[model samples]
Target: MVQNLNPATVQGREYLAIPGPSVVPDRVLRAMHRASPNIYEGALVEMTHELIPDLKRVARTEHDVAIYIGNGHAGWEAAMANVLAAGDEVLVPSSGRFGIGWADMAEGQGIRPRVLDFGSHAPWDMARIAQTLADDKTHQIKAVLAVHVDTSSSYRNDIPALRALLDDLKHPALLMADCIASMGCDRFEMDAWGVDVAITASQKGLMVPPGLAFVFFNDKAAAARAAQPRVSRYWDWAPRVDPDFYAAFFCGTAPTHHLYGLREALDMIHDEGMTRVWDRHAQLARTIWAACERWGSSGAFQMNVPDPHQRSHAVTSLRLQAPDGARLRAWVEAHLGLTLGIGLGMSTADDPKGEGFFRFGHMGHVNGQMIMGLLGGVQTGLTALNISHGSGAIEAAARVLAGR
Candidate 1:
């Protein structure tokens, strides 16, 4: 007979500190908790229409947006299918795991991905990118796919700098950005930054569950889509761009509950203001870094990205000795209620398995107290796990929060 082991009861509210699928706000949860609405025509339809404008506002763009009934991967496929066909070549300036993942997705669509691997801990090398584009006299590179803030490495690429490099090289290749991890938490101005296509999902900075993905496109990207040989009906944005009703918006049965949650999430974002939200994420990230810096003095832990300016405000990746990173994560969740992000395979030249790193997310709905709790939980885990760490980590974090 199979034995069923009952899990221990964990007291108090659990903290989800993973990079994406951030803790949903109570208001968004309540909005999603309600019953499914009518799909044909009603308040749901009107509310669904409102999402595009608000989404554009969050992206700080006037370009068009199409909502897909899928996760971030769907947005990736949609962006590629519309602009690229079989045998089309795209330049992927890889800084982290997700950048390579995007290249793999492009390959699935029969598009050739020319990747310039920049390892894991650093930002993109703009000079190399510029040279690559400049060498492509025929402009065989249809687009340059850049990840704005790679959650795996917690490295934030400068999109505007890439745009300037392209302009200087007189490259006509479209600039496509994957803002899945940075959309609401970091500063991204799609149109102003000269991004032709931007992709994001509901999970991360959007402060919602993981069902919906968005693809924002400018006139240039739309023209590229028009020039493509053929795009699958499901991935095509033409019909979904101006839908007649909720079903048409999604190309099938609408994600009614997600829409409700998204509406509430967007409301909260606008109410708090995007600038303020970005500032909060920045401060919390700094606090976490301060704590990690103080802890690193004992030679047990260090931040993945050494330079603070190059790191993402949404997530911070920390490096520790083997087993300690993994053990600390397990210990925190079992003893306390805090859950930290796994060390994704963002390997540097020295550390290949990436078992030495873990990520701390400070995006969406997360506040100062919540961050302090997260840091406190980590400190407890370090002590409980018998991991060697310098003292004053908590004080260091508090000082940062106190702006001393």
Candidate 2:
């Protein structure tokens, strides 16, 4: 029989360091811990109205945002449904798991995804994308689905560059970016980057628990939706854009607690200011990367994306020998109360079972001490597991955090 585990039994505060569903702030939690409120009018309704503008500020867009009662995948389906019709060909420039997963979602939606697979380690090859778009003389590809940051591989792609490519090629395809992992962590300018449609979730850098998904679309993408044959009423953004009450924001009853949590989370983001939030995430990521570099020097580990310029501020994917990654992860969680992200797309010939990979998420509600503690825990795990790693990994990370 399984032993009953109580929260008090845990030694210390547990760290959730996965790429998403990141550590929620105490304020957000306090905001969420409330009885159901009046969903029709007054505070709840007015608070809901405030969310749109704040969300747009984070997305860096003046476009319309539609909130849905779902996860990131729901955002995917909603964005696809709004702008794509059955059998419409979409060009998916895949760099990692989420990229390919988006393509799979498109396939399920009765749309043909012409995926330009760029493997799991690197960003998209612009030349290939340019050639593909250039070769499509008939312009059958209606849209380009790009993942701004692939949390699986922790690789950041160039959305603005993709948009520039589209413009240079004079392609009429709409540029849709999946910013699920990067919205608040990394710098994403939807309107300035020329993105037609952008998708993100309340988790990740937004610092809210999973439940709400947001889809932001410009006038061009809205026009495309209007011209499309049909979009499921449930997924349609037209009505949700200007809902009369809270229930209308979602299809039915409002996600009362999540909305409350989201209001507080967005307030936190705005309070810090978006630029500082981006800088904080970036600095935290760099500190982690610096430590990982030291750890990798012993040949026992490696970073999936070696280039710092291409890596994501939200998460870092690391490759190790088979079972070392898994063992280290198990040890850290079991003994040190730290949770690391799974190596999402790193299954390889030598590393079957994907046991040789893990990720470190440094996004949302994370601070320097938390990151230092996380690294210290990992270093302890490495030593306890007898995992070969260079010395002074913690010191290296500290130096980075100290701006040395």
Candidate 3:
């Protein structure tokens, strides 16, 4: 049994480290607290208008942006709807579970997926992508969907390099990105990367509650909109972005409260400036790697990805040897109500060796104290569970954050 728990707990407190539906900032939570306001009037409409350009700025695209009441999956379908017809083939670069699942979703929609499955933890090999695009002599591949950072495995990819590869091969396929895991936390230059379409959600790096998804698309993708045979209005991107009028962004009336929450979250991002937020995430990512390394050197624990540079700063997915891995996580949760992440869609080859790898999420409204808490919990939990790990992970992380 756990001991010495507090009722109110301390302020500037313990946080969710399992990623997505991240701890909504108190300001955002406050904004969402009231009953529904008139969808088309007062501050609601004003905030809606303000949100458009600001979202564009964060996406780094002058192109259109669509807001949906659904989650990231909705954004994915919206992006696909704008660019693909029922039978069109899409090239999907599968680096981890999410990418493959996304492709499967497209296939479910009657869009065929041509997969290029690379081993997990590696980026899309440009040569493999180029070769696949090159071999499409009939130019059947309609779009290439790339997941920027596969949250499940903590791997980041080079979209710009893939774009260059497509340009070099003269591949006619459009480039689409699933940035749900990395959008607000990682460096994403949509326009610069020449991405035709990209999708993200509020739950991860946006520091907002779930229930909102954004799809950004360039003219090339917008052009394809008129050509798609049938588009489910709710999941269609073009209409939502253009929205003849403001009400259309949310379809009929609105997910009124969600927009209120989103407005404050976006405001926070702006106040910090997106560039600085990206830098903060990058720095924190390095700190996480240092901590993981200190533990990994003991051989009792290991990171899923071998290369520090390749792993995500937003989420760290690591494998811990058991009978301690599961116990350590439960120990942390029971002791402090601090929940670590469970491995999701980790395949047969990976799961049999361990109970399930744990994940650390550092995205959205997170800072050093929270990260330190995460490491501290691990340090204590390892001791509680009698697992071996190097001490001073918290100090190493503090040193990194301090340097930043």
In order, the Cα lDDT scores of the candidates are 0.89, 0.91, 0.82
Compared with the true structure, what per-residue lDDT tens digits does model 2 show for residues 30-96? Answer: 9999899987778988888888999999999998999999999999999999999889999999989
Tens digit of per-residue lDDT, candidate 1, span 1-404: 22222345357689999998899999999999987788888898888888889999999999899999899999999999899999999999988899999999999989999999997867888888888998999989989999999889899999999999888888988999999999999999999999999999999999999999999999999999999888898998988897655576788988989999999999999999989988998888889988988999897688878888898999988888876888789878877778999989755556666666789988899998999999999998888777888889999999999999
Off by over 4 Å in 3: 1-14, 347-350
Q: How far does residue 387 in candidate 2 sit from its true spot (Å)?
A: 0.8
TM-score for each predicted model, relative to the true structure: 0.96, 0.97, 0.94
Candidate 3 lDDT, 1-404, residue by residue in tens: 43544644433455578968788889999999998787767888788878889888888899889888888988888788778988899999888888998999899889999988885656677788787888898989989999999988888988888898888888878899999999889999899889999899989988878888899988888778877777787777766766787678777878888888888888899999999999989887888888878887776687787877787879888877654566767767767778888766554464564464778889988887777788887887776666778766777777887894
Question: Which rank order by TM-score, best down to worst?
Answer: 2, 1, 3
Error of 3 at 253 (Å): 2.1
lDDT of model 2 at position 275: 98
Clashing pairs in 2: none
> Under the 3 Å rule for N, CA and C atoms, how many clashes does model 3 have?
0
Better by lDDT, candidate 3 or 2: 2
Which should have the higher TM-score, number 1 or number 2?
A: 2
- Cα misplacement distance, residue 260 of candidate 3 (Å): 1.0
For each of the candidates, the C-alpha root-mean-square deviation to the true structure, in angstroms, is 3.3, 3.0, 2.3
RMSD of 1: 3.3
